[model samples]
Target chain A: MFEIFGIPSNALFGQLLIGLINGSFYALLSLGLAVIFGMLNIINFSHGAQYMMGAFAAYLMLKYSGLGYWPALIIAPLLVGITGVIVERLFLQWLYKLDHLYGLLLTFGLALIIEGVARNQLGSAGLPYVVPDELRGGQNLGFMFLPNYRAWVIVASLTICIATWFIIERTRLGAYLRAATENPALVRAFGINVPRIITLTYGFGVALAAFAGVMAAPIYNVSPQMGSELIIVVFAVVVIGGMGSILGAIVTGFGLGVVEGLTKVFFPEASNTVIFVIMAIVLLVRPAGLFGRRA
Target chain B: MEQRVAEPIATPEVQPTVWRTQSATILFVVMVVGLIVAPFFTYPLFLMQAMCFALFACAFNLLIGYVGLLSFGHALYFGWASYLSAYSAKAWGFTPELAILTGTATGAVLGLLAGSLAIRRQGIYFAMITLALAQMMFFFALQAKFTGGEDGIQAVPRGHLFGLIDLSKEMNMYIVVLVIFLAGFLFIYRIIHSPFGEVLKAIRENETRAISLGYKTDRYKLVAFVLSATLAGAAGGTKAIVLQLASLTDVNWPMSGEVVLMTLVGGLGTIFGPVLGSFIILVMQYKLAAVGEWVLVIQGVIFVACVLLFRRGIVGELANKLKIRL
Candidate 1:
């Protein structure tokens, strides 16, 4: 009957692919969050808005500049990254001395402003972005048909995630970043421009979120409200992964996505809430998160 | 990565002087009188709605102000309580008091579960965990049969209070809401000024020191969390009964943000601040109802302005300038 667990093989594989796609975004977004949190000590609550901005940047580019997907992909993240630089320079700089909660609150306010402005302009409905011409078709694997764009999203996200990990874990700049996160005074004493590094790190992290947004534009509708709920899911993923190690963020992201995919097939109703349920359990058992250093 | 504590409340150990007592009494009387008389001047429903939010904001203020725990998911308690109470009132033929009590109890139970999980982590993690849990409950509400799937539990009968006084009469319902609000407000005031409140303040100032002082700081935080949730639930139950409906607006993240905004605008630690904040925000919402998303923008602007320039908030600044606590 080509059935596994009373579900068709195609349907099962299809949902798993969807889950992997979602997981790729989660890994990219969470990686950015961890990197930003590492350097700035701010949670960057406007991250979702920045992700939404990336999609909007692509849309605007295509509309006016007649830019295609690839060009928009490179340019959109740069544009959104510039905005993140502005945000860090203006509002976020003042909050470095205050409570961590203030950063969360301030960025939350920024998120609201960005989303609200977008909604006011765009009218809350989703706008469709065409899949790139090169990645428009699908391949019929023996078990399931996989769309090229979605597969591209997965591969591209994974590559970027690993590249980011390599940069942070192996490179000298990432060493400076890890050092700066631990002690800004020490880093400053070493004659490195810590403030500039902080600014750059925030920008880079935001760029990562925007990059995910551009990739997501084809698979999901580009809307003002798109990143709002997705951001919460990412938050749960962060909590599960512990936001400590780069690899932790990546592994947890994909793992949970597969688990969610399985849940969709088996339980269906819990598909929306399974991560949260797991989050509660993890919080109860290991409050430090899976990869977080025990305090 | 950095873990810095919130700013401490500059409590100067208010010595109870005779002048202070007289002034406080007079101020309290004037406030109660203003609230009573003001309803007649403007729309009564608006004032009632203001009172509901006032209670909600005050409940939220208790945790952030005293314990330094910013719960970003308070809407779960408020909205779920409203749903349970609304369901009981309309479907189960429960009295108004019973229904509201059901809602309040629901908040307490939820607080116990969420608090235990959240209190494990300090600062930002606490906020995140609470938010995640609240979102979880929100999904549950969205799908569950009793929540009416987005249309929400509508046209809930307010029924009668204690099976005698008819709540259908607007004046009667208003009085009940007013009395309930006053009771909750005074109850919160007592909690803040009590010895327990002092320990909560001590913990806010330095949690490790409080722990070293032989106080089970976690228990104190948990109790305070439950009390705040219960009060918020009471507020929500009152609101559902007054509005004759319970909807997703009550349980959404935006609703939680609005409560935080109200609390921030009024004053973080001041007893009278949340009520003032609630009135201001409620009026703003009513005026901006036509502009739609612009309200969100304005709220965002206020949040930024408050965090950046007006950290002490309206009442906190006034208290600072006047050299007296509100």
Candidate 2:
């Protein structure tokens, strides 16, 4: 019965929870994008399609193989990551030496093909993905009722994101990645197989997207079009964060997601466009983005 | 490395030989003649649609080819202009000519706004910013009252041109659309050949060098952006009148992608490439209508193929092989 700013506190907290959850996906996806872009200099326009594939992979696994959610989480990303590896070997490898825009175009083509195939097989109408039985219940947090699945999504994504950050920013392997990103020739001179590393880095970035996708399947409808819908907003997030620092991408993703949730509370009409509006404003003020170094 | 080798082949031939000029003139004459007689054999509406898309693709090419800036959200100008022209013709009862002008003006204004912000970034960031802004505009059109939400503005009247010739007839409408397309196409050609266009090309080639030459490169890019947007709007307005409807499909991201595809398939920088590209794509879409969603998959395949094997595009490759400035 308590109210804050003329709206129920429960509603506000609930929206914030939803926003946080959405932000988790944004962080995970953008993290993947930033990591790939750092090493490959390509924006991975198919990131969205890959995310959609992860969800669908889970859906198909459940439908055909009777795989449960727990196992699908591990298997779906592996499957999607292998697909990413094939895509890199077949199409994207040729584009590495070309203008970076070519990579964007190539990936965009991949996205269109993937989405079209999915749409052909499964219509546009969304298919429901049931929350796992263990995560079905909710917790009374006094201020708001938190669904266990939502809590798990937030916690699990944050853990994955942080672990990714630590691996890239704090470990020996991370140093190799940073070194390769900065000077691949130098890294190759050090007897590291940079091309192989590049290929694996791309696959890993794609796996991150798939991981987020599997997490999202339970929350959102498992639909072919879901990734495209979210990817543009994530692109805006990337622009706002400036594809520079890994931590920057993660922070910006979560921040913007919360802001979007707040907008739904105060001005619902602008919810769809608020991120873009912020991107325009950011471009006007700091063209390099909040955490990005000047290009 | 491959791109470096392909660059010399794809660059426009510097020496405008007599043979090249003669071929170009012959091509133009043939195109005009084809436009005049083809309507008799083919459906005028279909031809008109192709012409409109051709203009749109040309406008898009002006930015990507000449200015070296790829705008992924050109549908904002095209779709926004379509809506304005449709609304003016329907509600304000303006003449078709006036309505089209209004649409072009709207595009110019929107271009000024979007280009200023977009020009702040370079390369991939610029493309992404433009696309995000266009997505914002899409949301606006979706919620705005005048756009009529999902149904869009329907039955937009094709009023008399100059308040004289009736455009309700298919022949009259086709002529008006053709004339508009040709004028816009010629104007773009003139822009490319002008001193101003040379500066744009220079900036595209090397921004640092252009700035060192004391040229205000930003102003030049902005101007080119506005010009391209206005022409795109002209195409959109004409299509609105021809089709008698302005829908969300016009403003969506897919439409923007289609324009990019048309330019890429035809020839990114070639004068006549977009026209050919538009026709080929439209005909493909028409023929592939029965295949349902496979059309998208096919378009995707073409995109991949174009990027991988035919980077110079259909006409671009032919021009390179023949050593012509087509």
Candidate 3:
């Protein structure tokens, strides 16, 4: 019965929950992008496609191998990350010395290939993945009901994102990774395998995207288009956050998602474009992005 | 005379300037001759489609090739122009040329807005900004009233050009399209070959150096971006008039990617690359239209192959091999 700004509290909280869940995915994906760009210097245009693949991987695991969500979460990312490692070794390794745009172009091509192959094999219709038996219900939070799976997504993505930040920013291996990102040759001189590290870093980024995909499968159907549109919005997020700061990416991701959710509550039409509008304003005010240092 | 666009990825052998310019002129003449001759043998509608795309690709080339700014969202200009042109011709009862002009003006204005924002960051950021902005427009078109949502604007009349010459006739339409394509092509050539274009190339080659040398590089880039958008607008408007429709396909991200593919396949910095690339791609699309996503996979393979094996593109390689600056 309560209202805020003439809108129902339930609708407001519902959209906010949706927004938070979406923001968590954005956080997870953008975190991966920042990590990859820091080490590899290329925007993984296929990150979205890889995310879709992860969802599909989960879908297929359930259909073919009788694997549940719990097992697919662990195995799908590993399977996709292994492919990421192979891609790094075979195709992406050659472009490290070239212009950064080449890396984007290459990955974009890879994305098209991956998505096209998937669409060719599977129709573009959404295929549902049932929520696990245990997490099927919702919890009442006084104002609104929250689905347990969505709560799990928010919690799991937040945990994964923080864990990634910690691993890259706090650990000794993280220090070496950052060192290698700064000066690969110097890092190599210290008896560390920098190329191997770069490969793993890329694999890890891919794995993060795959993990988000696994999380997304139950909510949004396992469709080929799951990643394509999401990736563009994520790109806008990257521009707003700027790839220079890892933490900036996470904050911007979550912050923009909440903003988008609020926009959906207040003005429905602009919801599709609010993030882009924000990007334009940010470009005018802070060209380097909110968290990014001057390029 | 400097080729900075594809130079970093692949080092092409440079030829003597005098011979390169002469042969390039010869090549231009040959293209004009071929354009004049091809309509008689080919389907006029398909030819017109190819011409519009060729112009679009060439306009795209002006940015990527000369300015070294790879705008990944060019479909915004191209698609918006088509929509406006179609709406005007169908709704406002404007003549074809006027509708096309309205489209061209839309492109210039949009370009000014997008270019100013995108030029703030160079390289990968520039590409992403343009793309994100374009996608924003795509969402707008999908929701806006006049665009008619997914069905788009259909049955747009091929109104008379300049309120006089009829364009409904196939040959009449072909000639008009030919003139527009040639004029746009020459306009781009003048832009790229002139002092303004040289400054653009200078900016592309090295922005910091250009800025330090007292050239306001952002202004130059913004100007080039506007010009490119204007030309792309003209092409899109022409396409709308010729095809008698404008749809979401024109405004979507794939259309933008298609333009990039055309320029990349033709040659990034080469003069005739986009023209060739557009024709080749249109032909491929025409043939492979039935196979579903195979075309996308093929296009993606081309993108990968071009980036990996031949960044210079077909025309680029030819220019390098023949020791001419195309």
Candidate 4:
């Protein structure tokens, strides 16, 4: 029953929780983007489409294959990641030597195709995605009631992001990836099979997005457009965080989400543009981004 | 491919002129004559729609073609201006010309802001930034009461032009649109040929080199952006008058994508590419409206094909084959 800033604590905490949940998604998606950018030197514009595919794949699995959320969580990412691999091999590999802009354009075209097909098949309406019975309810967390599904998303995304960081920063395979990113030719000289590694890295990044999509399906609507809108915000998050550092991406994603959530609670009119306002400020203050390395 | 870049010109050949120029001139003449004669064949409303989009694409081409900046958020200006003009004409009951001027000025200001913010980044970042900014505008349009929510500002009046010409008449409106397109097209042609346009190309080719050479590249970019945006607003304002309505569809991201597809299909960095692209795409859409999302898929395919094998575009490719810079 306590109040803060003339608003109930319960309402404030609830929005904060929602903000954190959204942040987890931002962190996960941006993290994937950074990893892919590190290796490919291309921003994957189809990331959102692949994410949509992830949710749709999960929806289809449940509808026909009789699989539950538990299995689809693993299966969806795998299928989508394989699709990424195929795309990389068939189309993206050709652009390695071209202008980075071409890569962006090609991926954009692919995204349009994927999204268009989904829209045609599914129509524009959102389909219901029920949370797993195990994760269905809420917990009274002293000051606020927290939805278990949302809590699971936050925890799971945080765990995945940290694990990815640890793997990249603290392991041998991570060392190879970091080294390859620094100099692929040099890495290949050491018998690292750089091209295959690059393909796999793309696949892994897409897989990360798919995982987030699967996680988001139950919370958000399973629709064709679910990712298209979300991806732009993630792009802004990447810009603010600086694609140069993974940890920076993770932190900025969560921080911005909380800022956005707090804005919704205090000044709902500016809630939609709060992140953009921050981005404009960031650009003015530090064009290189918060964590970008100055060339 | 690498060898093609290595081949040097032993002798500078005179740039050959081709039929594209003649054909384009002929087409322009035909289009003008057709517009003058269009009332007899097509509905005035349909011709107005085509002219509006054609002008929009032409304006859009100024930036992407000559300047090499692919702005994905131009729909923001187009949509915003449509709203402003619609509001001015309908709510305040201003003359059509005055309302259009108001919309154009709004577009110039928006262009100035967005261009300044977006020019900081280059290449893909630039595209993404513009896209994000446009999305921000979209959200603003959605929340703002003036846009009339989902319904948009309905029944916007086609007020008299200059308090003399009645734009409510189908024949009168067609002439206004045709004149506007001609003026806008000539204005773009003038800009491209001016020394200012040369600076834009230099900046596009190599910004650092241009900066090092002591050209104020950012100012030139801003000017180009403003011009492009203001013209797009003119197109949007004209559209509002023709349709007698303004809606959210004008400012949405898909509208943004639609313009990009137009420029790509017509030709990037070419004078008349967008005009050609706009007509081709509009005709296709009209025919395939019932094909559902396949239009999007087909558009995507064209985008990919253009970027990969047809980067020069229809006009650009023809110009290249004939050794002309048309």
Candidate 5:
């Protein structure tokens, strides 16, 4: 019966939660992109397809193998990551010396392959994913109600983001990866295998997408198209946040998500386009993106 | 005569060039004849569809080939114009030519806006920006009333051509579509061979150098983008008239990808490549419509194969071998 700004609080809170959840996925995926772009210099167009694969993997694990959410969460990413490694070692490696556009085209082909296969088998309709028993309840915070699974997604993604930031920005292995990204020959001279590192980095980026996929399956539908639309928005986010800094990707992802959530509260029609509008503004003001340095 | 000719430049490829020019002329003549005679052996509607797609791909090639920019969201202009033309012909009862003009102009204006926005970023970023903008338009079409949502603007009339030639006749409509496509194709060819196209190629090859050469590269790019979009819109409008429908599929991202695929398969930079590629793809799609997603897989394979082995594409490679530009 209570209203905030002449609107029902429950609807407002619900949209906010949805926005936050979507933002969490965006943050995770963009973080992966930034990390991969930092070292591998590939935009990972198949990131969305890999995300879809992760969700499908989870679905298949539950359907065919009796795997639960917990196990699939771990298994799906690893499996997807292995596929990423295979793609990198076999096909993607050939594109390193060419224009970056080739990488985009190659990954686009890969995405089509993955999505097409999934569509062939699964059809375009969505399959259901159940929330884990452990994360089934909701907590009433008076101002807004928080579902346990959504809260878990937010916490887990933030934790992962922070951990990834720490690993890349603070660790010794991170230093070598940075060195290799800056100068592959210097890192190779130091007895580091840069090719393996590039492959693993791609795998890592793909795994990040898979993890987001696993997280998203329960919140949204597990469908072939789950990632394609999300990927475009994430691209806009990357453009807005800049692919330069890891921390920038994280902050901008969450920030845009919140802004989108607020837009849904006020003017619902523009909610879908707010991110793009912001990207346009960012382009006009700072073409390099918010956290990106001039190329 | 001996004092003149100040050391004639040595050229090693005159025979090949002459051969290619003859062959190209023969090929165009054959194409014209085939299109004119196609209705006798095959369904006129199918040929019209193929021509529409060929024009679309040719329009797409103008940007990627001449301007050196690859757009991922060209469906916006194509689809939007189809909707406009369809609406005009159906609701406003405009003649077919007028509707097509309206669609093309709509495409040109949208292209101007999108090109202005997308040209801000170079290379892959430009591709992504155009895609995102197109996605925004897709969402708009989905919600907008005139687009009719999932059902799209159906039962669009193939109005008379200038109140004289009835377009309801299959043969007549086919001719109209063919004429529009050929005109658009010739226009693109003219643009590509012109000094303006040279400036676009220069910008694509080296933007910084072109800028330093006292040319405003952005202005040239914007012009190229608008021209490409206008032609693409013309194709879309013709398609709407031919098919008598314009749906979401026309304007979706996948359709954009399809155009890119058509251009890539035909040859990215080749003049006549997209036309051949579009014909092949349309034939394949019509024959394999029942096979479901395998078509996508095959298309993807072709994309990968083209990128890796046949980067010049079917026409581009042939042109290269013949030592003459198409």
Candidate 6:
């Protein structure tokens, strides 16, 4: 019954909800990137692929093991996190001494390998993960119908993002991470096992990505190419947010998502490119990023 | 610290002798001769494709190798040029040479715009900025009607070169591509050896030092970026004529990644590295065509190997270990 600028309120609310959901994923992923970059000084190009792996991990859990969604959520991230630890130990360790570019290239290669292997084993057609019975229904809010699963995804991702923030910004372990990121040699001199911390931090960052992946599986198609498609936009978010602050990553991710959703309503043609256009403008205005310290 | 100090001293002494080596001269001649004669034995289309990609990679190498600036969005220039050249030749009915020139000019203008914006950031941020800008271009290409959307500009006419020589013939097209490749290659080589290149190299080696030493480092970087972009566009334009199409594949992020991969596999800083890298990658793609998606896996494996163990690349490692310039 209500309309703003001649557009129905339901359609607007619906897009905003979708935008918020997309933003939740962006926040989760970019947060993971910022955390990883904090310690490793490497942009994990495979974050998207790892996210996809998280989804597939859930898919495999259900298809072969007959485990339900809840258990898979717990198990998938751990499995993917373990793989992340292996990747860090086996390959990424050597690149820390080289230019940061090598880290980008190396991770890019890993992403290709993961995506390629997945594509080879499971074809490109996206497989749907069924929404669990408990979260299957929707509620009529008078203005719009809100799906329970969608609301759950928003809540779960927000909780995880906040929890991650609390751990890094408030906890003792977070203090060690912040200290080590500032001066690894000094932290090593302080008798902390910095390498182990580095390894675990990478795993934790990747686990965050995996968690987001599991959340995304029910909404988006579980496809091999899924990660590559989303990772670039996340990179833009990281750029815009200025990987210097964790909270920045969270705010920018969700904010950009809503902006993108709004674009779809007003100028549908520019929705795909609006973030990138904003990125250029931000670079022009503040090259250090909104939250980043000058490099 | 001592070993690090010794490296700079050792490099200058060895550089001149390596550049003038008898084998290096022979290698150059042999390569030229091989290029001139290869079309007779090999498929011209395949050769043309290799040459186009080789030129593209070389153009990419100019920035990363000499300028120490990695651009991840080179596909914007390459892909945009292909689209423009294809459109001009087909829609506007221009000659092949004019169409390619038009594409190159477009690439230069884009380079100026993107280069000015991207160079504001350094290292990792620079790479991301270029990539983001390129993605913007990709989205534009996807939506713009002139690019023909997903179908791309197909069946682009291989118009006559200069309105004199017919380019529809395979041999004619091959010759034109070869000429373009050689010109681009030799031009890059010449630039590298020039005094301007020396300044660019200095900037790459140490930007603060170069700036402190009174060099207008940003301007030099922008010029190099534009030049590199222009050549990449020229290559893409030439390829459009050869393939008679300009598609989204040329402008997408994957193509940008592929060029970076080629540069890495061949050798990042070496002159001939990209050429060898392109051949190796293209050959692998051809041989592994039946294997479907495994090619990406193999390429990824090569990337890991190159980063971890073979950072110097094939040409770079050989040049280092053998004490000979490639």
lDDT, candidate 1, A1-295, per-residue tens:
2899789999899889988988898899999999998888788788999999999999888988899899989999999999999999999999888888888889889999999999998879999999999998999988889899888998999999999999999999989988998899999999999999999999999999999999999889899988888888888898888877999999999888888988898899999999999999998888899999875
> Candidate 6 — which residues are off by over 4 angstroms?
B1-24
Q: What is the Cα-based lDDT of residue A69 in candidate 6? A: 91
TM-score of chain B of each: 0.95, 0.96, 0.95, 0.91, 0.94, 0.94
* lDDT for each residue of candidate 6 in B1-326, tens digit (9 for 90 to 100): 01010012113235555444655566667778998999889888998999999999999999998888889999999999999999999999989999999889888999999999999888888888898899899999998999999999999989788898998898888888988998999999899989999998888777888999999999999999999999999989988889999999999999999999999998887888899899889989999999999999999999999888887788887777766666
The docking quality of candidate 3, as DockQ, is 0.61
Candidate 6 structure lDDT: 0.90
Q: How does model 4 score on DockQ?
A: 0.56
Residues A1-295, model 2: lDDT tens digits: 5889998989899889989999999999999999999988888989999999999999999999999899989999999999988898898888888877788888888889999999999988899888999999999988899999999999999999899999999999999999999998999999999888889999999999998999999899999889987888888999999888999999999999999999989899998999999999999999999999998
Deviation of model 3 at A122, angstroms = 0.5
DockQ of each: 0.65, 0.65, 0.61, 0.56, 0.43, 0.60
The sequence of per-residue lDDT tens digits that candidate 3 reaches over residues B1-326 is: 23246673234356446666588788888998988888888888998999999999999999998889889999999999999999999999999989999899989999999999999998889999999999999999999999999999999999788888889989999999999999999999888889999898888788888989999998899999999999999999999999999999999998999999999999998889999999999999999999988888898899999999998899988877876677
The runs of at least 3 residues in candidate 3 whose Cα sits more than 4 Å from the true structure, single-residue gaps closed, are B1-4, B8-21
Global CA lDDT computed for model 2: 0.91
Model 2 C-alpha lDDT per residue in residues B44-154, reported as the tens digit of each score: 999999999999999999998887888989999999999999999999999999999989998899999999999988888888888899999999999999999999999
What does the i-RMS of model 5 come to? Answer: 10.4
Steric overlap count per candidate: 0, 0, 0, 1, 0, 0
User: How big is the positional error of residue B178 in model 2, measured in Å on the Cα after superposition?
Assistant: 0.8
lDDT of each: 0.89, 0.91, 0.92, 0.85, 0.88, 0.90
Which lDDT value does model 3 have at B134? Answer: 99
TM-score of each: 0.97, 0.98, 0.98, 0.94, 0.96, 0.97
- CAPRI band for model 1: medium
Q: Which stretches of candidate 4 lie over 4 Å from their true place?
A: B1-40
- Which residue segments of model 5 deviate by more than 4 Å? B1-17, B21-23
Judge candidate 1 against the unseen true structure and give its global Cα lDDT, from 0 to 1.
Answer: 0.89
